[model samples]
Target: MDPRLTLVVISSCIALCLGCTKELSVGELFYGSVIETKSSPSAKHCQILCTYELRCAIFTFSNFKCELKRDDSGAIRAVSSSIISGRSLFSCAAEKKEACFRDEYSQVAFKDKPYQTVRTTNEKECRSKCDNDPLCSFYTFYKSSAQCELKFWNLLPTAEVLYSSTGNLVSGYSSKLKLNINAKYNCLSIQSKGYLLENDYFDYTYSGAAFTVEHCQTLCNLNPFCRVYAYRTNGHCRLKLIKDSHTQGAKLDYVISGLRQTDCKPNFVGKKTTATT
Candidate 1:
């Protein structure tokens, strides 16, 4: 099972009973982050945009005015709306409603033999425990048993098998992935500020990826449509689009093959780098 499948309990049971319901609607206030914050109302407008965007788990309105930010991960909300706040959608029913975490998933995993049971207070704490232990990668929390389970291996069982506590048990796998590459590799010769010898990879996220001369060459070689490529020792990855594909092993601007593959052991990238995963 994926570490994100674990369930966390909230301590707000008592709080939920005492507090009056403060329901939220599509147009209601949703706390979010202002990806760009040059002005005050930018955050508020962002909130509106978030409301329009489906699949948006939640949003934060903060930073002087209201900043609209997306929270699909449903993990942590390191946001500041200067005002608006929210509890996890999973925790909306807790007695303390907004005071406890109620995410169905946690970032925890097993280490030794039979996976041990866990009882985390929230998703964050569950993940924190797994992260602290390098041996962990994924976790499963039984909603009924209120137990968190961890994993140390790579296994993907069906939902039927996973949720079936014998019938409804949660099951997941470690996110850590070990990659092995063929020797005929693509490599970049690094100068100051560049990867001593590195390669770049982009999951197609607009940004958050970097490349090097050698890395660019390797990327092109591995990819078909890599007619031209560029690299910056700036520690940031940038890939350009070329009309061509299948440009086999051509060197351009210090680009070359022989670069070693960097093992991506998902340890903290969130999507697939949590140390336990």
Candidate 2:
């Protein structure tokens, strides 16, 4: 066999095996404070810096500034409203991963009223909030409203089959234990639904198919950034890459809407040193 083909075969087999071992950082961000202002672009950058530092247990980023810390030994306070904090995951470790599945082109809604309501900036943040909260399990996100409707269930949620294609409304599950692909990604979508306006309204669709809502969702789940999609009952599947935007709103009934499952997977460059060394 050709060397490249052999490599591809090995890769495929590894991905196909459900029991494949995966390395993950078990670290969690406790808290952080502004230690110094260093030129940086975003909070992700600061996180990468903390991952590289030997003692950097936590980090904060705000107003184009980066602050790194060794531990939360002092009063845990935010420098300002803009400060974003994160911690290294070396302390936490990844075990055998599970397959992650989300309905990209469909959502499960309950007739029961939302148990709690939490304010958030986007879909990913809302999912994280739900994952962290002990009481939350299922949630619906209104993209136009920037509102997250958190719902709790003693068991799995299986209810009404309401679907939307062009609307900004989306639903998702809490982040429990899903497999990490090991690639660095900045955005993630848990689920979405809806499709239409084919002549020429939104022209960014990469492909179309005679697909069902469930099929559309699987396509979206395969992509790291595809949170939105339009699906029709006629089997027309329209894949979209229009990422999370705080300003986008719900659309017409002819279209069904979908949203991504979670936010960006926290990236760390220092994880290797911290874990292996």
Candidate 3:
């Protein structure tokens, strides 16, 4: 009855569909490339810096170099000369694609740190958290544990497709760089009084609280800027102020002790991964 109106509606619908489409691709290595590089204690540290850079999808770093690239299409490959090994970083940050994109997953981006433990919610909140933090590069959240881990690369495989229980745990796109630099060093590591020297310090202590050393470490790890930690039977987590003495506190469920450390590494490197697909 209204042929002209129907025709106009169909044309508009087609335009909308065409407006929202994108193509996707896959390969052995992904993200992009390392357009940059810097000196770091280890390859991981270098990777960390590269991951922080916008458009730094993947990189290869050595004592002398760091490389970044882009991979939207093709069976691309990278040949290396300097870096021992390099890989991509992980990401869970989603993108709002136009409606024409067929894949539902294509629209969602993941986030990965200063990652607050995963709570039930949407990517917007997670991204908001990351965006606010100057240090956060990307993030990934686990559906099972509801744990969110922040990341460096453009990708965040916070969703572990394949994983090993122990040995070397690589995230979605992470690999240790086989740099000429020393492996014992990284951007961050744990420090205790015994590990380094002390000059100035502060300690806030509590008592009669029971906790395991393991539990104490978890608390410290969770803290945003927790450099080191000490726990005793007194149920206290000494967020200590340390100096040149090189002393570290303790972690015990029911023991009494002080906390301090020296000679601790510069940054903490509990674990890391690059987001390559």
Candidate 4:
């Protein structure tokens, strides 16, 4: 082999092994199931944070904050242009690592929510204050006055009302925010009437005539890999599989879809048993 070609092959292999490449979806936000949150300066920095955590499979970056999610199973919501969501392809054991820079939103301010105001030379130092303070959720820095305002919410508000645009202001979230996962809440029974989740299937394992939606659910329940099912009024049943992630579907007329609350655990009998009505 040519020496240049050999080097190229070696580099490619190393990149794949470390999962250097990431798949980013701009203007997307994954709801719920956040394992951890941190302040990030850019989408690329957010990906690095996701890569560092063993449990982080996907992440969403918005308003200079990075939300690390356990998987891609959560509902993906289209949000503002600032939001960027992506999946990490790297393994936890990868050798390559990078330092994180302070992420800030210029000409933006988080309004009417400052709990503590302090003096700081730059946004990086301002961010450090928020990172150290447990109560701080976000902070805004004023460029001309060199003022840093650390803010926290008594109750978290909706994303729409989180930030506002202003000149000479920079804002960002805390560097680290660990979320408590309630297993019971995360594993709730999900059912949607009159909807068909389109183009979101991992695999279409089985499809056949089913009497009712309940019957289609039963079919999904029996399959070890099936995580979601869709039933049509015309008696067609479709079972889909997405291992270890919840499935989100779109709405369509005359269709019903649902997600299996619990993981599919199959118990094998002495012989293969036939499923009956």
Top model by lDDT, which number?
4
Error of 4 at 219 (Å): 43
Q: Which 10 consecutive positions of candidate 1 have the poorest summed lDDT?
A: 266-275
| Residue 188 C-alpha lDDT in model 4 | 40
- Over 226-247, each residue of candidate 3 has an lDDT whose tens digit, in order, gives 4445543333345433342245
* Least accurate 10 contiguous residues by lDDT in model 3: 96-105
Cα lDDT over the full model 4: 0.59
Model 4: pairs clashing at backbone N, Cα or C within 3 Å:
41-103, 197-249, 197-250
CA lDDT of each candidate? 0.32, 0.46, 0.33, 0.59
Using all chains and alpha carbons, the TM-scores for the candidates as numbered come to 0.23, 0.28, 0.22, 0.34
Candidate closest to the true structure, highest TM-score:
4
Could you give candidate 4's per-residue lDDT for residues 151-175 as a string of tens digits? 7642221111234455777877665
TM-score, structure 1 vs. true = 0.23
**After superposition on all CA atoms, what RMSD does each candidate show versus the true structure?**
17.8, 17.9, 22.3, 17.0
Which portions of model 1 miss their true places by more than 4 Å?
A: 1-27, 30-132, 135-138, 143-148, 151-192, 196-277
